[model samples]
Target chain A: MNKPPTIVIIDYGCGNLFSIQRALTELDVPSTISRNPDEIAKADKIILPGVGAFGKGMENIRRFGLLEVLGAFVASGRPVLGICLGMQLLMRASHEFGYHEGLHWIPGQVTKLRPGQPGEETVKIPHVGWSPVNFNSNNDGLFHRLQNGTYMYFLHSYFVTTENPMCGIATTTYGNNVFCSACCKENIVGVQFHPEISGPSGLRLLQNFVFLK
Target chain B: MKNRRIIARLDIKGPNLVKGIQFDGNRALGLSEDFAYLYYQEGADEMIFYDTVASLYRRNNLIEFVTAVSKHIFVPLTVSGGIRNVEDVQKILRAGADKVAINTAAIANTSLIKISAEAFGSQCVLAGIEAKRKENGDYEAWVDYGREPTGVNVVEWAQRVVDFGAGEILLTSIDREGTGNGYDLELTARVAQSVPVPVIASGGAGRKSHVLDVIHEGRADAVAVASMFHYYYAKPLQRMYSSTNADGLRLGAQIDEGNLEFLNARYGGILERRFDPISVKGLKSFLAGSGIQCRNM
Candidate 1:
């Protein structure tokens, strides 16, 4: 029998790590949550799941000393998935409370969804609840079997804008703001939505990631 | 416009799913996780697991429950009741809850709203406001699961929590809850208009049209229902629990405790003429047919 692939969910004291681990368990796939560089290096796939502030996320990742480990993992051309703030961390920088740096794996800058103008105050800040993602027909990377315009749960004040158009795989609209909800560049994949908590369609997206070559 | 969220609010006491009239006299329904998974499959936009007696006990004990539910049910989960400090908020979030709703603590120390929002982004903080209509045709904020009345005005408090960094307001009407009359549309409209953050109109939803009225007339961004969905699944869930059904097996694996007495009695011991069962899928389709946007079934 062929050996089962090893999946590692990076744990840096942010985001819901159990849900991601349990989602894979529901799929009958075994995985582990760790910040250990050796374990992460040996894994066939790594999922970077996170929630909370951008500066805190980057700080926690560095505090765990996963910077060089992650950099080497990305450089190895293996599958690396970043979720929510994890996706934001893959960008060049974020302008949340203050300007903060990111991994720059995918060239982009994370900024507030709506910068709050006079009439724009009507547009809600956190952008909570459900919004549909319009998949890029040309490159439907992780969203392979999922239908176009699939509604996914979103809860973040800031969003990512990839410098390269090819990196943008899906777009979602909230009020007047139309931003990228899912993106990928080469071997790196990231989604702004929490697939672990997003139901069956979300499970399918995770399955796609689990089997990616 | 973004899809209007239809959240399944489960009032939990001890380890069982429960429903109450005006936040009083809670009747155990079944297992909370069973109903939560059913709602998720039915295309409910989100789920709220409010520990009904957490405040009275002076601690939020739903961390284990939150961890178990977040595993199988893939949807946004909000844990409410007895969130006293930033550490409590951190613990719940760490347990896999997407958001934490604060009511009694925030009313006592409003700075909790600001500090938690700063500690964890505003998106993770929810301001839970339980409102009761006064004789003077105004509303007052009530805490301790609607037991004690605070002098704070509901409308003004709604705006203040948003300024204090609450991302959303869960507005529950004490006068109309579990009465099946409908939402307090006037109160809902007032808070929805005052706060820029999303206002989730909760309580007193006995029918499908009541949800429509709240969104259109009440101007609420989302609507949460407990009795309507729980009562509908009570009997069927009981049957599956007895048998070795696949869903039952899945539910059994996650939850080790539940109250099956209400299920065994078959709606006989409770108040007579309770609401007829309403499926979450049926409610969403009904809302969609009425031109209201919701996640597709």
Candidate 2:
């Protein structure tokens, strides 16, 4: 028999930890919400859930000294997931609330979703509510059990832009074109949408993340 | 030309459906599942379930209820009550609620609105305000199930909610509730004018005309009435439901006249549909833009 995955949700003082913990618990995954580095180090997988400005979130993680621990965990080839602002933190830097440095797990910058050029209806910033997210890669565990064009809820102002297209696993559209919704590179996965609040679709996504081998 | 919306609001007490007067007069009515299906078949565009007892209880029952309802219903559903922080909102939405409404939390933290809105999106984050007319004729914000006053001016607080990223405002009036005297149009208008996002008028709605009046005159994007529809004393119900044959009413009214025409035209089948102003307006706009000639009646 295989043991369930031990998932540690990083409680960086700016996340919806309990709810994410509860969702993981419902999926039968063993998860804990903690700010301590030891608990995160001992886990099979880690989740960074955040819900605030980029600078403040990174500041809290740095203040708590969980940054090195999380970086070490990611380097260990184990699964690490960053949600919402947590995903943004994986980028090189963010322009939100003034410029600030991120974890730089992914090679990119976090920029706002602005309107299109002349004669174009620019998609508004903070694309909210249930929008359809389509997978770009078919060989990943994130999109394994899910069908194409699945609608997931998203609420964010800024998005990550990576030089490497291989990092993007799924993309969703708002006004005109598509933007990266989920990105994966090796054991590290980042999602801009809250799989916890995305209903059954979100639950299935989380379940996929938990059981990813 | 935006689409009209059909919304169903489920008032819950624990696991069962509850109906009462205002915020204090709640009584368990029946299973929420049954009513949910009923409203879905009736052509509700979207559904919202408020856990009136959520703040009172230690745990939120809205998640389980939303899960059950999501299995059977395909429309968008929003759940609210007792959400104190971002974590609470996350749990409800992950459990199958498309949106989470926060009332008391917004009054307490104020920042919770921005956090949830940024993390979840403004559309999924709603700010529900329970207001009562003060002695000076101005509506004041209330908290703790409408028993405590926040001392914030209702209009000012509304602007703040929007600024904080509340995609929509759920405004409920305590004074005119259950009285069916019609909505506090003045208050609703003030709130609608104050916020840039959509405002859902709650509290006092006695007749179908009141719903129309609030949406058209009060400038509310949506209206929520619990007791009027639950108790069955809701007048002009049929007029709003199947009055498609009336001439003076707008083309939007005809589309909502009955579920048959609406379903045959909209849903591709015959289903009993309750007409919501949002959905009706959308249908009208669609027809008008498409050049489909149809009279108001």
* Regions more than 4 Å wrong, model 2: A115-125, B1-8, B13-15, B20-27, B31-126, B130-157, B163-168, B172-297
Instruction: Give the clashing residue pairs of candidate 1, or none.
Output: A197-B74, A197-B75
Candidate 2 reference-contact recovery: 0.00
- Counted clashes in each candidate structure: 2, 17
DockQ of each: 0.53, 0.06
Q: Put down candidate 2 lDDT per residue, A1-213, tens digits, no spaces.
A: 578988889988887665677677667777888878888888998999987689989999999998889889999999988999989999889999789999989987888876466687444345544566778879458877677877565667778877699888888776664678898878889999888755567778888888887
What is the TM-score (0 to 1) of chain A in model 2?
0.94
Tell me the tens digit of each residue's lDDT in model 1 across B22-127. 9997766656867787787787778899999999889998999998877777888899999999999999988888789999999999999999998877877999
lDDT of 1: 0.85
The number of the candidate with the highest TM-score is 1
In angstroms, the error of model 2 at A116 is 7.2
